[model samples]
Target: MKRILVPTDFSEHAEDALKAAAQIAKKNGAEIFLLHLLELPNQMNDAVTNGSSIPEVMLFIKKANEKLQKIKEQPHLQGITISTTVQFEKAFDGILSFNKKNKIDLIVMGSHGSSGIEEILIGSNTEKVVRLSDIPVLVIKKDLDTFNIKNIVFASDFSKEIKKPFLKMIEFAKIFDANLILVMICTPNSFKTTSMGEKTMKNFIADFEVNNYSMHIYNDSNIEKGILNFTNMVGADLIGLCTHGRTGLSHFFNGSISEDLVNHTIKPVITFKI
Candidate 1:
């Protein structure tokens, strides 16, 4: 990979993400783009442009610059070229558009870009970006799994739809040299497929060369529980989910497995966008 993109807002949380991105880029021999989004406070721009309320906008811009400055001056970023950009709009959208126009191979951003009760009410832009971005997103948190990705738990049902995307996942696994735990959860009462059915399924997976892969079928009525049980069993450093664009009620009542995995697993989840 030639370029790595790290989006920031200058918060302590964001700084932590930048640090993780730097180490990953340094190890992978990739250039770094240290980006900051400037959503100017237009509502209060004229109100406090120069008034006694505080130099609100300029103060933020200055802080943003300082964040990038600290990153550039860091000893670890010596050879890695770091570039910065600021855009006046929504944060996630800006980063998404920039990636298409840049050499961005991966994105590293904070999990909770909290701005008060929003953090307690619902997740911030970080969760939204994870749902929308096609690239591999590493959402930083206070856990060793964020930096140490030696073990990967790939949540799959061995579906045929994973054919093309599975190749991409395999590519990542090879690069990271991470162990993949292939968990296939089945309903508790559902009997095993017949010998003939097993033969067909084996033949279906035969070409994937899953010799190193360990598969398990979790017997539980709750699919989410099955996934968590599997994740715990493998002690995953990262959880990989392959999305097929399920939305709305299907996601809610149907127990959107990917979304549930995010909430349940403390380990960083990598949802491979299909």
Candidate 2:
């Protein structure tokens, strides 16, 4: 990884993401980009005149910059190369824009999982970014002092289209020298026999010359639950998934398994867009 983009709201959760990103950056000698989004009301959209921002908007930007400086000065981030940016846009849009402009290899962001009415009314920004970003996104939930990845549980259907993302997952695993637990979840709606599942997984991995990985078939009520159950059972440190980035009516009918796992699981999740 060359560059990592972290979108922060300056919450404790955001700090968790920063710490985790710092660990990864230290490992790879990558630069970190800290981004803070300033969303103004529609009436205040015209607050920028010529090149000067209005007083209120400027105040917000200034405070955000100060916070970014404090974050950069944190003990864990001391030796890392850090750059900061404050943008006047929605969180999701600003993150995507910054990543595109900076050629970020990965996006590491924290999310306080949403639920109940809040989730129904307005989904979290992390969910939106993970759904759209072409690059890989790593979602961190809690603070991690070490950010170690000993075992990664990668859940997939072992289909032809998943090969590209599966390869990406393997590359990530190699970074930590982590063992890969390749699982195929069998739900009632899409059930598969153990023999069939094993054969399919074998055929899928046969194309690649991957080592230090094991394959298994898990059964549960749904894909998300199956993945989580298997991850917990194996004590995996990270969860790898491939997102189809479904939207509109398509998403409504066929809910996103990757996004759902990102929200519900406390374990760190890394998603690759297929």
Candidate 3:
């Protein structure tokens, strides 16, 4: 990774993500862009709409810059190259615009779980970025000091759609020198025989020339639960997923499986669009 973009709201969860990004930057010698979005209040928003005085908008950005300056003084960011910027936009829009203009190699952001109904109305900032980002996104839920990725559980259907993201996942796994385990989740509604499951897995691996990776079939009530159960069983350090699976729109109506995993799991998740 060359550059990491971390969007922060100055929340504890966002701070955790900043700390984790610092560690990664130290390891890879990458620069960190610590971004804070200055969302205006309704009155200021209406002022801008009516071409009123720019004092309110300017003041908000000034405060945001002051906040970032305090964060920049933290001891943990001493050795790493860091830059701070404040944008006058919503969190998601600011992140997307910055990523596009700056060419972010990866985005590391934090999520404080949201319910399905809540997500359908207004998705969490992290979830929105994951859905829209073209590059890989790493969602952090806990305060992790050392990101020692040992075993990565990549749960997918072994479909052609997974091939692209699988390549990116492989590169990420190699960064940590971790074992990449491929797992297929078989639910009651979509059960697959052992032979068929194994056959599909073999074909998937064969097409990619994947070696030195483990494969398995997990049976559970649903894909999300199956992935979590298997990860716990094997003590995997990370979870890899591809956004927008076979079902597409209908599947991600409230939130995609990848989004749900990010919302619920404490384990770090890496996702790429299908």
Candidate 4:
């Protein structure tokens, strides 16, 4: 990871993410891009639009720069070459544009930036960036400020088809020297044999030299709850997910475990497309 992008709103979650990003950058000799994207308020409405306030926009950007400066000045972040960037637009679009134009290796952003129904972490903006961006996204969930990422629980189905994205997850695990726990949650009413499930997971891990990893299988009625329970149980710092992009009824019913996990778990989640 030679280049890392961390999108911040100067929130606690973003700060935690910065800490994790800094640790990873320090270990791998990478440069940090601390980005603060302005969701330029729409001033089209006669009662609500402040969209054309160039001076106000600049002021916000300046304040964001000062915030990043303060973060860099902290003794914990010494020796790290941290840079800042601020853009005016929709939060998600700003990050996507910046990532592509700058050739960002990875995007680290908070889970919730602005309040909304989806303000589960950095809000819906973080999710959109994750969905739209080609680069991998690391989401630092709000309220996890300590950032002691000793373990990463990778929530996977152990799909038979292996792809290039798996390599990214492997690299991150290797980067942190974090333990990989491959967890599969099964339905309680389902009558599948336990051994069959274990075999699939074992084969998946076998592809990698994951001698340090372990697999856990459970009967879960609720995938989201299972993930939250497992995360807390194991003290996982991050939940790694491989989204297969299932849609329609499957998507609505099973939903996105990664998203649900992000909303429910206090720990951060690192997600990638399969």
Task: Encode model 4's per-residue lDDT on 1-274: one tens digit a residue.
Answer: 6799988787777787788788778888889998877665555222125445466666777888888788889876788888877666667788888888889888887655223315633336766666656767877655544555668887656675434566788788877787888787766543246898798877777777665578898666777677778878887778876644342001212454534555455566676765
Query: Candidate 2 at residue 189, lDDT?
Result: 79
User: Which pairs in model 1 have colliding backbones?
Assistant: none
RMSD (Cα, Å) for all candidates, in order, is 5.0, 2.9, 3.5, 4.5
Arranged by TM-score, best first: 2, 3, 4, 1
Off by over 4 Å in 3: 42-55, 113-122, 209-212, 245-264
Name the better of 3 and 4 by TM-score: 3
TM-score of 2: 0.90
Error of 2 at 124 (Å): 2.2
TM-score versus the correct structure, for each prediction: 0.77, 0.90, 0.86, 0.80
What are the per-residue Cα lDDT tens digits for candidate 3 across 1-274? 7799999999887888888888778877899999998788888878877988887687777888999999989999898889899876888899999999999988998766333323521456665777678788887767887878889998888887678878888877766778989998888777899999999989988877555589999998777788889998999998887776233211321334643444456787787777
For 173-203, candidate 1 gives per-residue lDDT tens digits of: 6656677776555554434454533454465
Q: Write the per-residue lDDT of candidate 2 for residues 1-274, one digit (tens) a residue.
A: 7699988899988899998899888888889999989888766676563455678877887898998898888888988999999898888788888888899989998766434212311456776777788889998877788899989998888888888877878878877888999998888878889999999999999999788999999999887778888998999999887777765101211355634544456788888888
Q: State each candidate's clash count.
A: 0, 0, 0, 7
* lDDT, candidate 2, at 10: 93
List ranges where model 4 is wrong by over 4 Å: 41-61, 112-123, 142-146, 189-191, 244-255, 258-260
- Model 3: how far is 200 from its true place, Å? 1.5
Report lDDT (CA) for all predictions. Answer: 0.63, 0.80, 0.78, 0.69
